[model samples]
Target: MTNKVIQRLGLLLAAGTGLWGQGSMTVTDAIRKAWVDQAGLKAGQAMVDSRKAEAEGYRDLRLPTLTLQAQGVRTNEPMMAFGIKLNQARIGMADFNPLVLNHPDAIGAYGGSAVLQQPLYTGGRITAARKAGDFMAQAEAASQERRKQETALAVVQAYFGAEVAEQALKWVGDTETWVKGMEDFVGARVNQGLMLESELQRLKAFHAQVDAQKAEVVMQIRSARSGLGLLLGQGPVDGALATPLEPGTPAPAAAPARRPDLVAAELQAKAAGEGAKAAKGNNLPEVGLELGAGTLHHSWSQKGDWTWAGVGVKWKVFSAPDLAKARAAKAQAQAAKDMQIFKEQQAEHETRVAREAVTAAEARYAAAKDALAAAEESRRLREARHKEGLAPLIEVLDAEAAVQGARTLILQSLYELRVSRASLDLATGTPIEGVQP
Candidate 1:
């Protein structure tokens, strides 16, 4: 029977979608994998690209720009014909002999110019834009970090939750079998007139209760399987997770400072501040420089020597009603600063809560372990006493029930402790590092 059970376990593991190695997959591994695989993380990454482009656009502020322009014309007559004398040129319209102009191959409208422009200043728009880019990048980066961190935490919770359910199922299965065995044993004894029929009936009642509990655990496992699938990026229709429901091994705590969520929040605040600065800078004047070159030929042959060059500048020195705009920007900055303050407070609160949960779970686990041991001892004593005719069958049954109950409680408490530990790592800004499952 033991070998058959092992074979069944193997078959289940082979069919399961989320199993890792020979044991239940680690929570940390599951979380890190989900973080990298979740669609939302990829979407957040796209935002980062946009922010980078915005920053690159800002870098263009200090660089020169060049534009190329070209035009072609084969007119019946020059739109602005210039009658070129041997040594002179005229601005007004004049018809020259087509043959003579043709000899020089006049190209009245066939010229291209390369124009260059430089932003010398923008009433503070350029500076503001640069600052805004910086902040925007920071914000997006922070947002990405936040997304990754949240994904990790979510995966951890879901993975361990499924694990707990699996463990529960195993516990129920074992207890149910044991209860059935007890019933059969009592029936055999009663058939031989060694135990009362009432004792057999009581054992049967206990078996029924165990069966009910087992059914509930099975349903719980199904729900847990769905959650685990989602976290591992597997579809719910995949074979349910079938890894061994072993107790989780301890994982080392990470450095609190390395917490991604905390870093992300910090970056967000910085980004917000930058945005506010950019808004304020919008009121400043912007300056720019422009340059262009053009050449016109009198004939298609390009004998006409005509050239032009120019440079210009601009500035937005003042706006009479700009106070409202500046004030609005100031208000926005203040709001962001306030948000930063709130975020910091929230981080501290989460950290404290995580610490308390870990402490509580640890204490509860210790207590449950002791209770389970004591109950098992009591049951053993009661069973011996009943066989010796010193205890009633009801007392022995009661003691056995207590032992089973303690086992269930211990399982629950252990799961709770591990879950709490995972939460603490997340809350304290110390994520468990792990490879993909």
Candidate 2:
């Protein structure tokens, strides 16, 4: 079989599995499929998860820290030997002798300790850090939502682009059939001396042109399908799309809502502010409480155990680096806030532009429909006249070409209208395929 037939068979087979199993896949189905399988969106979700995990870690900073240590040592040094004997509670009256104290025998001691340290105060550093982490996680989650919307927008474009190519190809096929019939009619007329040989040759040349156009359109259709597959996180797909290339109706425009990216920026700004506070907190004093219990044994028969509790304060009196870091963090926070404001303004502009584009697309689609109607009527009249021998074959051919051109234009305008409507939804932060951003 020819490549075209093989391609068609491949499409039919693909339609028998997965989402396509229900029949030709619709635009909504394609968007949902891409949401599940697209690698970029998966990566975005992973980043959000990672941020949440980090935030959890930051929140756990308030808990106490426990450390356990074990040590065994033998020393012949007089001072160490005396200390070891004292710690093991094995000191003897003989150890008081100057001769023994100056020249002590080797002593061995084993010790173990468990220490717990709880923060009493951290100058708000821990709180700020936790808040910053939470904000970062929220920001990442919002960013992921924006990524989903962006992915949905891409699926819409690729899906409809394939439909446009297929529609054009269908019209080209009709034109080809018409030209073939004309070629046969002209050839028979030439044989009967009713039509010139040059007329038949002219008809044959137009037929070649139509065939060439069909081949180009077929390539376009193949390319669009491959691109759609890539967006869906699959390799080349050859399934028929159920979504038709019809003009999209414009929805009532609502005031633009805050897009996910804008929300992300706002959250990121808050996170930066918290980060600055955390950095500033580094300059303040810290306080903590520690509780420890330990045991020391010189021999199995002679052992000493003790417990202790204490509180400590730590202050960095003058650290130039800490001061600089705090200043830098504050500056960065301000910059982030400023950037968020700029993005909000830019988003407003984008929404306005997108709405205008939708309106223009709708108008163009309506005009194309009217033009197609006129072209179809003209084609019918020209063909009728040619059949009655009142019009030239060339006028019939031209009329057919005009009708095909008009049909192509209508398809193009309808595709644009669909895309523009989708773009408007994207700009307004509207949900796509019922997926909330």
Evaluated at residue 361, the lDDT of candidate 1 is: 80
Model 1 local distance difference test score: 0.61
C-alpha RMSD in Å of predicted model 1 compared with the true structure: 7.3
Estimate the Cα RMSD of every predicted model relative to the unseen true structure: 7.3, 5.2
Residue 436 of candidate 1: its Cα lDDT? 22
Report the number of the highest-TM-score candidate.
Answer: 2
- List TM-score per model, in order: 0.75, 0.88
Model 1 compared with the native: what TM-score?
A: 0.75
lDDT of 1 by residue, 1-437 (tens): 12233233333322222322224345555665566666777778899999989888996777888898776554433333343332124342323556545454443355556778887655556666676677678767766776676676565555555555566567667766766766776777789898888888777776676665656556555665665566556654223334333345666644555455455555555655655566555666555667666555445554334444444444335665565666776777677677777877887898798789878887887897899899889988987887676888788767766765666556556656765766676666565434322
Candidate 2 lDDT: 0.80
